[model samples]
Target chain A: MAFLTADDIALLNEPQLAHVATIEADGTPHVTPVWVDTDGEHVIFNTAKGRVKHRNLERNPVVAISVSDRANDYRTLWIKGTVEMTTEGADEHIDRMAKKYLDKDTYPFRKPGEERVIVKVTPTQRLSQG
Target chain B: MAFLTADDIALLNEPQLAHVATIEADGTPHVTPVWVDTDGEHVIFNTAKGRVKHRNLERNPVVAISVSDRANDYRTLWIKGTVEMTTEGADEHIDRMAKKYLDKDTYPFRKPGEERVIVKVTPTQRLSQG
Candidate 1:
């Protein structure tokens, strides 16, 4: 079965931030609010290297992400997946993240070493309800 | 160890909204965004009676909630818990919800049957990183 319905994808495409959960080796869960960008195929986000989420993903990539809009009643989206980290290209990573959160005019350019570690989630399951 | 740090609790206490995940009977996860309130004990939220989140809770109450601050550099709160639903006092349910999201001065009084069913989460784990 499809993890997300048409309505669920609609909810995710709305411009909003989402909370992401990453699980630790001992089974503890770590969650953080992140700005996300979605293509028809995957969801993307970033985090610092020293953070627990980063560590959790290194140990195990299983995760859950939830998103919503406030004024629209109780609309929400939940995505579960494996996180794939990329250091593919510093400039490109920064560019994608900047576009998601900053307008073109204010988007910051990044130096090669200053780029964020990017994560792409190919959602294994998505559930949404309002 | 505490699932959330002191800084995590402060983030949770902020007026921002959160995305919550409730698990289904077959183990799929349902997530929604919600306005949350903290009494320093449990996190509270509500859902419509017929929604997937409500049904998920009835079958399996395990849930995860994530909250954050936007302007702050990556501040976040991830809470995992068991959900308890209440139909206990309709008037009080409406009152508490209104106070959390709406102003007390303009809060609407509910007829007993018009109140929302409330859910209380006793967080078993909290993890915060930013």
Candidate 2:
């Protein structure tokens, strides 16, 4: 199984923001900041099913995610991975991520009538800088 | 012409970091944080030729760039566009970006024997959140 190193996992464990990239149906790429998590072996983020990223990944699971330490400009990790799993606990996942990132107990921006989807990625390659 | 709003131009004009996403030759997406700049109308960054991203853009110019407000996660701009220009002057461009991001007049990470490539993007679609 793909795994982050002890040091790298520690880096990712912080509340730093992450950017997830996915390809559009027409081949254009789309990027957005995400609240990231890990299940020991896979990276994770939560979004709605019909969002651009979810739609893109449904058609093509390949992705590259970059996590940055905002306090230190030179520190970062890049994960080139595929969506090995799309699970259904986005509501709870977003809450967990919200606690980590926003210090809030619940995801602050969740809207009414919105559905949630969880994306889990398995890294095929990784890179780092500091 | 595609353009940013007054509020967004101010957000992006800050020294915050950006993540650029490009499509691979095989359809996989690649992403990395970059020191970003603007020509008031175009987005710019300096990279080296033959790098995975440069090669990818050469093969497929479409790209997605996301700039975040490090101090505030909710403020950002997403620019989806093609590489409108690949120009020279990367040395100077990198130095300029270094000033903005690192507070140094010259880029400190320059390596010997490496060529610099300047890539400029014209946003065809833009999105923002605050």
Chain B TM-score, one value per candidate, order as shown = 0.75, 0.90
Q: Fill in the DockQ of model 1.
A: 0.30
Q: Model 1, range A1-130, lDDT digits (tens) per residue?
A: 5455677666666657777766555553445677676655677776656667778788777667777664554566667787888867534655666665675533364434444677788889655443
lDDT of 1 by residue, B1-130 (tens): 4444677667666766777766555443445577677656778776656667677777776677777664553566677787888867634655666676675733364444443667888888655452
Report lDDT per candidate. 0.65, 0.81
* TM score of chain A per candidate: 0.75, 0.90
Off by over 4 Å in 2: A85-87, A127-130, B127-130
DockQ of 2: 0.61
lDDT of candidate 2 vs native? Answer: 0.81
What is the CAPRI rating of model 2's predicted complex?
medium
Task: Give one digit per residue, the lDDT tens place, for model 2 in A44-123.
Answer: 88887678888888999988999888898667889888895455677988899889988899988888888888888888
DockQ of each: 0.30, 0.61
